[model samples]
Target: MKRLVALLFALALAGATQAQDGPAAEAEAAARMLEEATRALDDASAARDRVKALTQTVRAYEAGLQAMREGLRRAAVRQQALERDLAAREEEIAQLLGVLQSMSHTPAPVTMLHPTGPVGAARSGMILADVTPGLNARVVKLRAKLDDLVVLRALQDSAANRLEDGLRGAQAARAALSQAIADRTDLPRRFTEDPVKTALLIASTESLDGFASGLSQIAADPTGAPGPAAELAKGSLPLPVQGRLLRGAGEADAAGIKRPGILVAAPPRALVTAPAAATLRYRGPLLDYGDVAILEPRSGLLIVLAGMETTFGETGEVLPAGSPVGLMGGLEPDDDGIVPARLQDPGSDWTQTLYIEVRQDNTPVDPAQWFRTDKDD
Candidate 1:
């Protein structure tokens, strides 16, 4: 019973030192990123080149919010695991507590007495002595579990405010980026777009390959082709948007339709950027692939990004690498100010799909070959 009381005291101090590990560190990292993003937003407000400043601000907000969401997710998972473990040991814990209470209340002389006489009493004492260590070990395990739960609860509570602020900041940054892109005109143009030729190409072409093949004819200036091929970036392009791969190239969908592109599941309004310096050859509704941005990195290499709610940049404009291209589409959270679903249920808010297709020499190629697909996030 004295041991049990000491174990209870130890449980109170269990997480004090342990809280600096894993989930707590994640929360701290998220806090730093959010703080940095706030400062970026402030700087963007007064920046001479608002487009570049806002682009960085939006990316910072995205990174910060992603970290904060991941921390909350880890905390949620840890809390659930702890709860399940405790629930599974409920009966054993109750019995242990009962035994401790009985020992605490019972008189020593009475406990020493046995119905089977002195021999039985001596044997019972020896058994208890041996079992004490095992019981102590169980108490230590329970203490550790309780400690983890306490820390997780505290982390969750503290993260709620930060998460909300991050989400709001991210939204504001995206809106600003969109407006900045709209008001910008400093980007160099490879050639002016021929709208009539573009319309004819769209009207005449039946497939992505055909449209890509006809893209060169739509440039108003026949001599003004995209600068140089991004040959060095062939196998090392970054994903235009942050997402998880849903399906690889040519994978059949539920409707048995197979396309020559990879599908990426992204959260709503995720920023999509140019993976390499490219000329915006075409942008708008094309075929049945929703809003699309077609980039010509060089003469024959075409990068197609489809299924965004809104597209940015003008056709014929030479966009630098990492330039904002568009945003993935999905429903916003309800007006009650609840956090995004991903915070409550990790990975659940990836409701929008971005389709990426890389074509070289007017032929569809696996996007995975060009972009690093080994990373999970």
Candidate 2:
């Protein structure tokens, strides 16, 4: 790679020695631009690796934190439920005790010893209506309390377990986040050119056409580090994210447009992973496709995952299968709180849909053939 860069540098110097005011000068500038672009690709690849590693770490940490948050939410709900149960039980117990005390109170003196008198008979009838039912009510309330107590104890145990899991998850997340930050901060770059050239290259960062043009000029195998031959694993690749498939490749949509990729139904903030070990071609906002990610699992094969609200990492990074790429977007499962409404595409109903497209030789192909189909099946 260094040799290639040196050769480009030599070309630039040669053009300068033969400096002319016509086509020759234009050729020199073109050569320099090509050289700069090539060098930028190399540097980007290295920097992106750092970004990918860090992104994976950060995503992992997020997963852990999410778990912890969910745990706390569940625990709190259970705690509230337990409190309600206790309060209800206390009220019922107090009512039952009152009935029992009333029944035990000595009968009025007029009816105490007048066994066959009118007052005594009337009092006996009152005992059947009031005292007998109170005794039965006590039995029922006692049994209900027993059942409730069992449930309350079980809930307590579950809450304790979830809280423990949350604590461990929190610890793991912190460690991963710290490590990711350190790795990203320590990464070095390959391009050490003059600040002006560096600035020019940076301007082309998000310009796909310019960047692609630069990649076109570079010879394959120039660095002797050939990329993965991902074609060999075709028809057996895994889906990047875990979820149900909403649309298959080449399927027509409601808008009467044929889809090039498959759409998968995923929750907001769900984990997105690489289907295979490969380099990330690009990760950024693309035309009308919110937060897209392009990965090269193998030479000549491009895998695109798009329609995310947020994504991690950058362009030019390579990672193993199952490595974190980014997260999907949707309203949280347990959240129904009020939020400011925003105008969205009528065709795009839920924000949780992720589009997947696999291109071989830059042509769209059926992704179902490469990935695990019938995901739910």
Candidate with top TM-score is 1
Off by over 4 Å in 1: 3-6, 9-17, 106-130, 220-231, 332-346
Worst 10 residues of 2 by lDDT: 337-346
lDDT per residue, candidate 1, 98-213, as tens digits?
Answer: 76776777776788799999999999989988987887777787787787888777777777778778778888888888899999888877788777888889999998778878
CA lDDT of every candidate: 0.80, 0.53
**Candidate 2 residue-wise lDDT, 1-377, digit = tens:** 22323332343223212222322233234333333433433343356464454444434433443333333334334445646776877876576555545544545554345567878777876775675555555455444444444443443343444334433443343344334534553322211224343345446556433433333232233343446544555567776765668888777888977777788876456667888877766666665678877777767777888887766554445556766677677644232111112211212223477888877765678888788867531
Worst 10 residues of 1 by lDDT: 332-341
Clashing pairs in 2: 230-298
Model 1 pairs whose backbones collide: none
TM-scores of all models? 0.85, 0.48
Report the alpha-carbon TM-score of model 1 versus the true structure: 0.85
Prediction-by-prediction clash tally: 0, 1
Give me candidate 2's TM-score against the actual structure. Answer: 0.48
